[model samples]
Every structure is written in C-alpha cells, then in structure tokens.
Target chain A: MSRPRLTFLESSLPYAVNAARLIVMDRGMFVADFFLATTVPFLMQFLIWSYLYQGSSISRSFGVLSLSQTLFYYAFSIAFGRLNNGYDVVSNLSLNVREGTLEPHLLRPVPYPLQKLADFMGGGVVYSVPIILVLAVFVFIPPVALNSFFWPGWVLLVVVSQILCFTLSWTVAMMSLWLVRTDFALSLLTTSAAFFGGELLPPYLWPEWLRPLMSYNPFRFMISAPAQAIVTMDGGFVMTALAWTSFYAIAFGCLSAFLWRQGMKRYRGAGG
Target chain B: MKKYLLFFRLGLAVELAYPVDFIGYVFTTLFVHLTRFLFLNGVFDLTSTLEGWTRRDVMVAFIFSVLLSSVVDSFTPSIRTFVRYAHTGRLEPYLVQPLDARWVMIARWIRPGSLFIFAIIAPIAMLTLSNLNVHPTLLQAVGGLFALVIGAIVNIAVMATWSLTTLVSKRDLPTEFIFRQVMRLNQLPPSLFGYKALTALVIFLPIVLTSTVPAMVVARGEYFLLAPMLGAAVLVMILFMISFRMTMRVFDGSGG
Candidate 1:
C-alpha cells in the first residue's frame, strides 16, 4: 500500500485557525456559549416539553412518533438550534461592509461572495463541532435511537439543508448594502426563524391556522424538516425535505449573486 | 445629572434624526415580541401552565423582560462601538477627559431605538396588569419600583463588566450576543429552572432580578421578595466593581 502525501491547503488554513481562535482564545465566551447555546436551550426545551406533555394524552404521539421518539425529536430540535450558529458569514460580511474593508476587497480577482462563503465555511466547520458534541450528549442521555433505514437519508438532508440555511443567511447579509445597519433585519430573521422555523417548538405544535403557511416557509426547512426526517425516517418525507431545501438553496443562491452584483455596482470607495 | 440629561437629549436628537430607521427598528422589535408572545401562547395551549406559570404570569414575565431589557438597551453601547474604541485606542480621548471614561461611553451611546421600546412596552405592561386587574397595591407598586431601580443598577453594572472586557481583548467578545442569550432567562418563570439554575440566574447572572422578581411583585403583590432581590442586586454591583478593577489592572491601552 502506498502512503498518501499529507498536504494542507494553505489558503484555507487561516479561517480554520480563525475559527479555532474564536472559541479557544475566549475561555469565558466558550463557556458562556456552551451553556447558553447548547445546554440551556436544550434544558429549557426539555423542561417545557415535559410540562407540555404532562397529563396531555390528546397528542399522544408527537407528530408521528411515540413518547420516546417525541423526547428525541425535541432533543434533536434543540440540537438543531446550536447547529445553526455555523452561519456567521452573514454577520461577518455585514460588519466588513460597514467598516469599509469590503471596498478594498471589491477589486480582488475572486468573487467576494464566494471568498466570504469559503471563509465562513471554514469557521463553520470549527464552530459547529462543539455544538454537535453537545447534541451527541442529548442524543445519548435519552438514548433515542434513529430509524436505521432512513437515518442515512436524514443525515444527507441535514447536511444539504445546512448549506441552504447558510445561503439564505448570506442573502440577508447582502441586503446590508442598502440597509447599512443589518441589525434589525438580522434580529427579525433570527426571531422569525426561532418561532416559525420550529426551533422553539415544532411547527406541528404551532397554531393550526398557521401550519400550512409555515410548512412552505424556508425557515421551517432550516430546522424542523431535517430534525423530523432524522427521527421519522420516512422515505417520502425525506425526499420532500431534500426537494424543498434544494429549492431554497437555489433561490437564495441566485438572490445573493444578484445582490452582490448590485452592491458592487453601487460601491464608491473612500478615495473614489 | 445635568450632563446626563444633556447627553440624553443629544442621544434623543440623534435617534429622531433617522426617522425611517427608527420606525423600522421599533416595528421590528414589536414584531419580534409579538412572535415570542405567540410562541409562549402556543406553549400554554399545549399545557395550561409552564413550570407552574399560568398564561398571565408568563405574559407578565415577558412584558417585564422587555421593559427591563429596553431600559438597559437604551443606555448600553453596541458591541461594535466597544470594539471600535478598543481597536482605535479612542479610550485615550475618553480617559483624558475630566469625566469618567465609562460615563463618556454611555453618554454617546444612549440608544433612542431602545427608548422607543420602553415607551411601547411600559404602556402594554401596565395595560396587561390592569386588564388582568393585577392592580398592584401601594406597597406592591413601591416594591416593584424598588426592584426596578436595583435591577437597573445590576443591569448597568453587568453591562459595564462586559464593556470593560474590551480593555483586555482586541476583538469583540460576543458580550452582547451572550448577554442577549442570558437575558432570555428573564422572560422565563423562575419555576422553569431548578434550584441550581435558579440560584445561578438569581445570584450570578441576576437575570431573574431584572424582570421576574419585579413582575411578581406587581402581579402577585409579592413585596416580601424586595429584600432578597435588593441584596442580590447589591452583590452584583460589588462583583461588577471588583471585575472592572481587575480588568483595569491588566489593561494596556490599544496594545492588545
């Protein structure tokens, strides 16, 4: 057997270190995030659901799952919340735009959006690991087993859906060109996602009148669909989830591309 | 006090200058609150109570959380400003001034957007109280006001600690992000947390001191909590003083 050469991609190294440094350098922040992002949200959800399920037998099976499955579903839902932090590209790009660093980068040979996306993915990989580890704890503590037949597809859907989520977030960030202050938009997006995206609770549990509309929303696909698919392991559900995610990914990608072009066209640098 | 009022007036003017942005922000905040209320309502729909909190209790908690956060947010500087000052060594200018550096920072950053929120939420909170006929007694009102004062102090002290972190770190420390996350606890009832978590929120983070205690005082006439809540707030202020002092010791102006 031939030994393969170990090669590190030099271009990608900085963002990896950047990501690692983000978590490692700030011990206080890491600890805070571990609790606030992972531990507390899960605890909050678990407690709420526990109280919610108490003495209520009407929804005996929580969205096509038994009691044990329902516990895992909610656990996984909380896990999905942590996983969503990987998309920091939006905030980073908006900051860069505001600080005027983006002006210099406009003339670079590589597309600014693509480069930012790559840098973001680099950080995403590093930032997301601990969250996944936290998720693993929740997955095991309750010992919710996945559906073997559908687990593989569900995993695929999650990966793809995450990319779609990133794209949608990035598109929102590009709007900072006009908005200048993206804080309100970002806050709205996050708040909307938490509520409508099924992060706080499943859309299945939201008001019935709103369910049909929420089911079509991209934010729901961002968390609920993948989370449910992994647990439910329904083939048809998995396929639909993939289809909706792809639709969003493509839609958001085009929107981002268009926005980037428009922002570039409008760019007047400090010296310009 | 005159300086603060002058700065606050200046802050108000700056806020009102951007009419469109300000209106947009207020609307967005209202939308966010509406969604949260809906989510809370949805949760209650599943169960009559959450962690022993009735819908009214939770709604009141949510309102008070918004009020307290708005009170803090109205004065607190954005994390970006902290990063900018730290990076550019602008702290020197503030430091050299006759006034306190922290006060200077606060003077410049009184968020009008947040002030608007206070205007909106305060009325809603009172209306909700009256609608539920909470009709806080004279003692309850006084106790709740006392809680608010101490809670605001604790809030400022805690934010000051976060702001002072810029003295040591070159980059923004996610102080604001972590703060927003921690403040979410304010919207939740104390019963949602167990003993350990409750203790952490009460003594360490003091999120419960911000909204829950005050809301309870008014809503349930729980004036007995005044002493303990005030004590916790004082402890937090002292802790913040120590943290700020220590942070100053390691501070190298813009050298980080």
Candidate 2:
C-alpha cells in the first residue's frame, strides 16, 4: 500500500498538537514553573536596582527616566528572557546522542534537527505569548509610560527579536553535537548570554570601555535592541536594531545547519 | 571518618578525570562571581551604601553566601541521586548496609570538586577584611568561625529535611527550586529587610544564620547574636535527625 505524502502542514500538526497537549496537561506546573523562573528573577532584579537608587537622587542614570521606568525596563527584559530557554534542546539532544537513541531518530520521516526545533518552538509559543500579552497590558496602563512615539512597528520588532532569540539559543545548544558533554558548555553559554545579553543590567550602565564590545556583540541584539526600540522610538536606532537582529538570525541559522551536517558525519553512536 | 576520606579521594579522582570540565567549571564560577562584584560596584558607584551597608560589609556577606552555597552544592548531588535511587526502588542496597542509610547517602555524593569554590572565597575574604576601616579583633574572628560552622550545620540539616521529603513522597522533591530561593534571599543583607521579614528568615528559612549573621559578627563585632544563632542551628539539627528517622521508618515499612 502506498502512503500519501504528508504536506508541511500535515507533518507539523502532530508536533503542534503534542505541544498543546503538554500545555493543557501541565498547566498548573507551567504556572508555578514560569512564576519561579521569570517572576522571582524579575523581582530580585527590581529589589537590587531599587536598593541602588535608594537614598540617591531620583533622576536618570543609564538613560532610564525614573525609578518606575527602570523597573519597567527590567520587568520586560525578564519576560523577553523567557524566549532564551534552551535547556531542553541541549539536554535532550545530548542524552539521546549518548544513549544511541539518536540513530533511530535519524531514520525518522522528519529531519532530527527539525523535530527538535519544532519541539523547541512549540514550547516557546505556549510560554512566551501569554507573558508578552500581559506585559503589553501593563505597559499601556496608567503609571507605566511608553515612549510617546511607540507604534505597531515596535511590537513587530519585539516579535522578530524574540524569534531571533530562539534561533540563536538553539544554535548555541547545537554545540552539544560537537562537545558530546554539553553541561559545561551549556552553562558557560547561558551565563555569558545572560550577562552579555543585558539581562542583568542595561548595557548603557556597562563600563565605558566595554561599551564598544557590547555594541558590536550579537548577544546585545537579542536583548538590548528590542529594549531600545521599545523605550527610545528613534528611527535610526530602530533600523539598526532590526538589521542586526535579522542578520544574526540568518547567520546563526546557517551555522547551525552546517554544524549539524558536520556532526552527523562524525557521529558513532554508543552501542547498547 | 576513614570511609569518608576514602570516598572523598575517589570522588576527587572521578572529578579530576575530566580536566577540561573541571577547569571550565572553575572559570564559570569565577566569572559568575565577577559579574556579581560588578553589579555591586555599579550600585556602590551610584550611592555610598545599600540600606546602610558599606561595600566591605556587603562583600563579607556575599562571600559567606557563596561559601554556604558551595557547601550545599557539594552535598546535594548525592542527596538528589539518592532520591533517584529511592524512586527506582534501588535503595535496597543502602538499606541492607550495616551503616546508617542516611549517613551513607550523605557521604556518597560529596564532590571534592566544589572545594575549589573556596579558591575564590579565600582571596575575597582577605580583600574584604583589608578593605574594612575597622580592624576586627581576634575574638570577633573566633566568634565568626563558630557562627560559620554552626551555620553550615544548619544548612546541612535543611538539605536533609528536603531530601527526606523525597523518601516520604516516593518522588523527587524540588530541592533546586528551594535552594535557589534560599540563595537569592541570603544574598540580601539582613539590614535591608524589615524586622518581621528578618525574623521569618531566621526562624523559618535559617539561611540568615548562614551568611548574614556570621557576616555581621565578623564585620561589626556583633557577637551577641552568636549564642542564639548557635542555639537555633542545634535545634534545627535535632529536628532534622528526628524527621530523617521517621521518613526512613515509613520507607522501610512500605512495599513501594
């Protein structure tokens, strides 16, 4: 019997359904997990920054307009930071590779890397959307002021940046293919990304000598670019931000594909 | 004690087998700490102090927090693996051993690798002391040592409590989640929080005893708090032991 060739939509349906099912089944766990993962870190950052500004003049430093403005910056940064979670892809790939399960996956209908990417994006869709919507609500509320020039293009830029964030994280995770032991590399990447990505502190507040390093750094494109777009509505910065983000997205995507191909040639599975 | 030494040697050998991994880990730890130092520098640049805490005072407290965290990390891998053993019904070997199962489990997973954290801790501690305008007396140093020792015990007891919960539930306890919360809270100096929050941390969380109290003792010569902190650590240790025994009893009697 001949089986019908499944279209892209048809093949993607199963992965999408699986993702949606996991979301429904683990709804409560997701809430708590997201709270602990996103909220706690956000609150800790707020606490630290508040203490820094405490008993000091309440004026701007690092281009932040006010304390409330600074808090808003950190609050959304953490929310956007959610898109950078790549632990699952790294752990799952390394475990499969080590256990020799990846050999079977290689023979499956869908490309193995695509399957993994689909899974990553599926989970991302579930986690990042609601949080973004909630932040948008807060940004529009009375106390929290957006830049006067805020427009639809700003939201589109954020969405594109988030997609770039996911691709870059996945590419970084693909380094597991070469290292085999991804734990060390994964932590190193994540720690560096969080620091350089400006999740810890804004890059403007970064040391003057370090500013050149941060300006050219792709990691800054992932975090600070979108943030700048949201806050400063300057046309020139927005164009540059979009350009760098799209450039990295394409660059890392090609790198990841190249690495996967090279890694597959070198792979000899662990025998059971 | 001999068995523990033997286990420690074996653990060190295992960790040292992967030289690249070890070096990478050490550097990552140093880098993480460096970022923290930078964060504090950024803050102190803007203001003279954080809620009345000078740079040296905060630095001392930060080192204590890192030290306590390292101690916990050193021991909890074994505790987590032990929980996995229980989950998979592979705990029979430990149960059949002549020694106490809890003690054996605790001794099994001590990674000598974490001892390297002190490599950073030592130099930072010295720098912090030298940076201090007030010269600490020998008595304050001795009192601080006592507080640190007692604080380590309290932390161990807290870990054991969480590890024991895995046995009772026959599943993994989210020890990492709890540990993260504790570490973040401990990073804050006790002075920053209100009296009620500080009291809650002291009695309930007890991480305050680990870093904040000891840092206070050493930096400000607050020796008066040492007696109560030691007393609290002892009480927590006793409670932990009792809880472990009861949890083991339940595990032994259950078919699962």
Candidate with top lDDT is 1
lDDT of 2 by residue, A181-227 (tens): 55566556666666777777777777788777767677777766666
Predicted candidate 1 versus true structure: per-residue lDDT over B1-256, tens digit per residue? 7866776788787677657657777887888788878878877776676666788877776777777767777766543464457656665765575765556655555675787788877887888888976777898888877788788778777776776766776655666666665666566777677767766667677754577788778776666556767778788778767876787677677645
Best candidate, TM-score-wise? 1
**Colliding residue pairs in candidate 2:** none
Clashing pairs in 1: none
DockQ for all models, in order? 0.49, 0.36
The alpha-carbon deviation from the true structure for residue B24 of candidate 1, after best TM-score superposition, in angstroms, is: 1.8
> lDDT by residue for model 1 over A1-272, one digit each (tens)?
99675344454456456766766676676666666765555566666666656675346545656655666665566656555543366666667766767766666544566656556555555556654674576568767566576767776777777777778888888767775656666676677677777777676777889888677788888777877776665779998888998899899989888887888787654320
Model 1 regions lying over 4 Å from their true place: A1-28, A55-71, A138-152, A270-272, B78-80, B87-89, B194-200
* Residue A175 lDDT (model 1): 66
Report how closely model 1 matches the true complex, as a DockQ value.
0.49
